[model samples]
Target: MCTAPGSRAFLEVGGRHYRRCEHCHCTFVRPDQRPSAEAELAEYRRHHNDAQDPGYRRHLAQLATPLLQRLPPAQSGLDYGCGPGPALAGMLREAGHAVALYDPFFQPDAGALAQRYDFITCTEVAEHFHHPADEFLRLNRLLRPGGWLGLMTRFQTDDARFAQWHYRRDPTHVVFYREATLRWLAEHHGWACEIPAPNVALMYKPVL
Candidate 1:
């Protein structure tokens, strides 16, 4: 998000207040309502993500297939925010790419952050960001020029469905992005963005 001051109250769901950023149109939960590190880690650990799971692989393919199609052979990539099971990293590795994993709770490797990558995959991770501005800045710094930054997260389309939306119900999901929000991010960061699949966005950094 654009870090602009003064966001209007967007919604109130289950005692948590949501605010809309005037600059980026991105919606985020109030800081006071956000889950603590311990609570967030506990919620994440409850997920059963297996690298070998076929269904999970297929779900991840929504982002991976498009990204794989665009990547050059044997490129170096980073699976940013890869959870307890880095299935997406394994998928990328199977396609002959060198992949590094980084997750604050599960695989916190500072060395990985020091290096740049040809591509970065952030699947279902952006929503958990407490400070999206800083997170996106880190992602931009981690990618080489002309590199790809692929993301997968459910888009907030209809306000009517927001109250009952399953994606926002998760305590860990604090931020929500719309198509416009993604486009704003691309323009602000000097990247070309495209939506190749539902809930999937592919952004390419310009070669300087």
Candidate 2:
């Protein structure tokens, strides 16, 4: 009953019950098992996410490199779910792209959500989606024609490894995506999808 019928497949990982979607191949924590909003926000606040961190910049560069290559100069972008530090937005700005920041707990700039962008970056953020389908639609609507959406998250490989996957151990990370799941999302929204790097995907919305 998550997102739609035929989307939830139940399983037990380390005695924790999880659900996998046949439609999109996204694994998810059960609603009751999810952490409280305050707890989730507190965890986010604990992240260093420092703009000056070389290692963190390199991690963001994984998505930024490809996305920058595809975009023309002076393009505007939104760093969706840009947590407390919002280093990604600063990186994009440093490259001369006009960037906006939005995070439910951090930036909380609702007006940013009301605007469209030439591209949107959701790096390391998709798994936090409570309503993946709805959030996807919102991102789609936020993009200008022929815009792109860049995402970076670990893709679910298979059932066996999923049991021991370190990414799943995070309480805030609920929905999980497979490569096929990203493809399905692209097809669902009539966008072009490409994997420019490992654990990174770029989805392009066609111009009218």
Candidate 3:
């Protein structure tokens, strides 16, 4: 999100309030409506996303497969916000890449954030941001110039189906981005952006 001033009331679904950013077209839940950290952690713990599960691996492959194709050999990467099971990190590691894991709840390593990487994978992580602007700035700083940032999140498209959208139903999912929102982010940060696969975005930081 651009974090520009004005935003209008967007929707009220299941007693939660959402607002639409005028600058970036992002839909985000009102701050007061967001779940507490403890509640969010509890909700995340309920997920059974195993790294060894074939189906789970396949699900992650949507972002990994495309990202792998674009990466050079032996690149060092960070799997930012990797949930309890970091399946994507393992997949990237298997492909001859060095990947570090970092999750606030599961693997909180401050040292990992201190190092810069060649690429960063943020799978299904953006929507959970409480302050996307700050989080993205951190992501950009953690990447070396010309580094890649791969993201995978269910995009918000149909306003008509928003109420019935399964992605929005998740309590932890507080923000939603459209293709336009992603483009705005790329433009704001001076990165080249591409949609290599559905629900996936590949952003390349410019080399200074």
Lowest summed lDDT window (length 10), candidate 3 = 42-51
- Candidate 3 structure quality by residue, lDDT tens digits, 1-208: 6778989999998789999998899999998988999999999989859889999899899999999998999999999999898899999999999999999888899999999999999999999999999999999999999799999999999999998999999999999999999999999999999998889999999998
Clashes of 2: 0
lDDT (Cα atoms) of all candidates against the true structure: 0.95, 0.88, 0.94
- What tens digits encode model 1's per-residue C-alpha lDDT throughout 1-208? 7899989999997789999988898999998989999999999989869889899999999999999999999999999999999999999999999999999998999999999999999999999999999999999999999899999999999988888999989999999999999999999999999999989999999999
Query: What's model 1's TM-score?
Result: 0.98
Write the residue-wise lDDT of candidate 2 on 1-208 in tens digits: 1365665556777667798777677788887887789999888877657888999999999999999999999999999999878888888999999999998888889999999999999988999988788898899999999999999999888788777789988878888888998999898999999998889999999987
Cα distance off (Å), candidate 2, residue 89: 1.1
**Residue 75 CA displacement from its true place in model 2, Å:** 0.7
Best by lDDT: 1
Distance from true position, residue 170, model 3, in Å?
0.4
Query: Which residue runs does candidate 1 get wrong by more than 4 Å?
Result: none
